[model samples]
Target chain A: MSGQLLVFVICGAFAVLGALGLLFFHKAVHAALSLALVMINLAAIYAALDAALLAMAQVIVYTGAILMLFLFVIMLVGIDRRESHRELIPGQGVVAILAGIGTLGLLVFAILGSFPAQAVGLEAANGGNVESLAALIFGSYVFAFEFISALMIIAPIGAMVLAQQARLTAKKTQRERAAARIEAYAQKGVHPGTLPNSGVTALQDSIAVPGLLPAGRISTSSVSQAMVDRDAVVNVHAVSLLTAQRFAELSGEVPPAIIKPEPVDLVDTKDERELLK
Target chain B: MNPEMVALLAAVLFVLGAVGVLIRRNALVIFMCVELMLNSANLLLVSFAYAHGSLDGQVAAFFVMVVAAAEVVVGLSIIVSVYRSRRTTSVDAPDLLKL
Candidate 1:
C-alpha cells in the first residue's frame, strides 16, 4: 500500500473512533473533546487529499474556535448534568435506526450506480489549492462570499440579543430581590435598612474591641471595623443599617448580626462561634 | 488506491455520523455527529476534485467548510440559549411545539 493510503487509513480510523467517543461519552465536556479529536483527524484527511487550505481552516476554525465555543458553553452551563437516558419521544430510537439504515443503503446504491470510476485530479488548476479557491471565491462566487460575510456579522448580533438579559427584566428582578429581603426581615421581626452608600471609608478610631459598639456607631469607623461590628451585633437594629445593607447587596445573604444571637464574649473563643463571630 | 474506494469510505463515515445523530440524546453530541457528516462530505468532495482533475470540487468543499463554520456559530448560540433557559441540553427536552 502507498504512504498516502496508509495515512488515510490511520486518520480515518481515528476519525471514526472519535465520532464514536463523541456519541457515547457520558460527560458533555468529554464528548466535546472527542469531537475536537475527530475534527483534527478530519483536517489531516483534508491535508492528505491535498486541500491544504481547507486542512488549515478546519483546524483553525472548527477545532480551535468552534470547539472552544462548545467547551465554553458546556462549562458555563455546568457540565455535570448528564442527559437523561429516557427517550423523549417514544419509538424515536427505532425509527432513527431504520432511517439511518435506509439512508445509508440509498447512498451506497447511488454511489455504486452513478459515481465515475476515475475522479478528475486537481492537476488542471493553475495554482495551489488556496490560490485557486481564492480566485473562484473572489471571481465567480463573489456575491455569495459577500453574503456570507453579512451573515457572519448578523450572527453575533443575534446571539447577543438572544443571550442578553434585558434592562427592564433586570430592574424587575432587582425589585423582586428587594421585596424578598424585606419579607425575610419582616418574618424575623426586624425592619430592613435603606440602601447603603457605595463608597466605604476607613475607620479613624482605633477601638480595641470594635464589636462592643452598636452597629450604627461602627459605620463611622473603618470599613473593616464596621464589618466586624456588623458581624457581632446581637440586635439586628444594633447593626448599622448601612453595613447590613451593604452586606446584603454584596452577598445576597443577611448579615450574621441579623441571623444569629449575640455572643457574650468578644474574643479568645475557640469554638465555631469564633469563626461565626 | 482508487478514488472509488476513498468515496466508499466517505460514504461509510457519513452513514456512521447519521446513525450517531439519530441515536444520541445529547444535543451537543448530535451537533458533533452532524459535523462528522459534513466532514465526510468534504472528504468526498476533495476526492472527487482529485479524481476529476478539476478544481471545482475542492472549491465546493471550501464553500461547505465556510457554511459549516457559520452554521456552528448559529447552532451553538441557539444551544447555549436553550441550555440557559431550560438547564438541559437534551435534543428531546425542547418540545414546546409538539402537539
Candidate 2:
C-alpha cells in the first residue's frame, strides 16, 4: 500500500471512532472533546488529499474556534450529568437506524450508477489551492461570499440578543442590589453589618439569601447558611423539598409548608461576625 | 489511494453522521453530527475534484467550510439561548411547535 493509502486508512479509522465517541459519551464535555478529535483527524485527511488551504482552514475554524466555543458553552451552562435518558420521541432509535441504512444505500447506488471509475488527479488551478479558492470565491461566487460575511456578522449579534436575559431580569446596579439587601435585612429585624464600600456583599450572605426575600419560620436562606456553616446536617431530601418550596414562592405560587426540620442554631459566632467584618 | 475507496469512506462517514443526528437527543451533539456530515461531503467534493482534474471541487469545499462556520455561530447561539431559558440541552425538550 502507498503512504497516502496507509495514512487514509488510519485517519479514517480515527474519524469513525471519534464520531462514535461523540455520539455515545455520557458527558457533554467528553462529547465535545470527541468532536474535536474527529475534526482534527478530518483536517489531516484534507491535507492528505492535497487540499492544503482547506486543511488549515479546517484546523483553525472547526477544531480550534468552533469546538472551543462548544467547550465554553458546555462549561458556562454547568454540565448536568443526570440527563433524562427516556426517549422523548417514541421509536426514534429504530427510525434513525433505518434512515441511516437508507441514506447509505442511496449514496452507494448513486455512486455506482454515475461515478467514473477512472479519472485523473486534481490539476493545480490558476495558482494553487488558496489562490484558486480566492479567485472562485471572489470572481464567480462573490455575491454569495458577501452574503455569508453579512451572515457571519449577523449571527453573533442575534445570538447575543437571544442569549441575553429578559429586560425585566436585567442585573441591578451595585447600589440597587445593596439597597435591596438592606431592605431584606430590615424586614427580618436583623442589622445588616456596615455596608461594604464596594457594592458586592460577602459570598456567604449572598448565598444565604434567596432572590425573593420571604418572611417565614422555615427559610431556605437559613438552611443554606447552615449548610455553609456546617452547623447542621440538613437531610438531602428535605433540602430539595425546601428548594422546591422556595422556587414556588419565588414564582408567586402558593408554597406548601413541607416537613420543617428542627432549626439548627445559626452560626452567629462573634469570630464569624468579625470575619464578615 | 483509490478514489473509489476514498469516496466510499466519505459515504460511510456521512452515514454515521446522519445516524448520529437522528439518534442523539442533545442539541449540541446533533449539531456536531451535522458538522460531521458537512465534512464528509467536503471530502467527497475534493475527491471528485481530484478525479476530474479540476479545481472547482476544492473551491466548492472551501465555500462549504465557510458556510458551516457561519452555521455554527447561528446554531450554537440558538442552542445556548434555549439552554438559558429551559436549562436543558435535550433537543426534544423544546416542543413549542409540537402539534
Assess every candidate by TM-score: 0.69, 0.70
lDDT for residue B12 in candidate 1, whole number 0-100: 76
TM-score of predicted chain B versus true chain B for each candidate: 0.96, 0.96
RMSD of each: 12.1, 11.9
Chain A TM per prediction:
0.61, 0.60
Tens-digit lDDT string for candidate 1 (B2-83): 6776787788778878888878888877888898889889989988877777777877887787778778877887888787
Q: What is each candidate's DockQ, to 2 decimals?
A: 0.50, 0.55
Local accuracy by lDDT, each model: 0.72, 0.73
Clashes found in each candidate (C-alpha, N, C closer than 3 A): 13, 0
For residues A182-234, what per-residue lDDT tens digits would candidate 1 score against the true structure?
Answer: 89798995446753232222322233223323422322222243344335323
> Across residues B1-99, which tens digit of lDDT does each residue of candidate 2 receive?
667777888898899898988888788878888988998999999888877877778878877887887788778888887877787888778989889
| lDDT score at residue B11, model 1, on the 0-100 scale | 82
Highest lDDT model number: 2
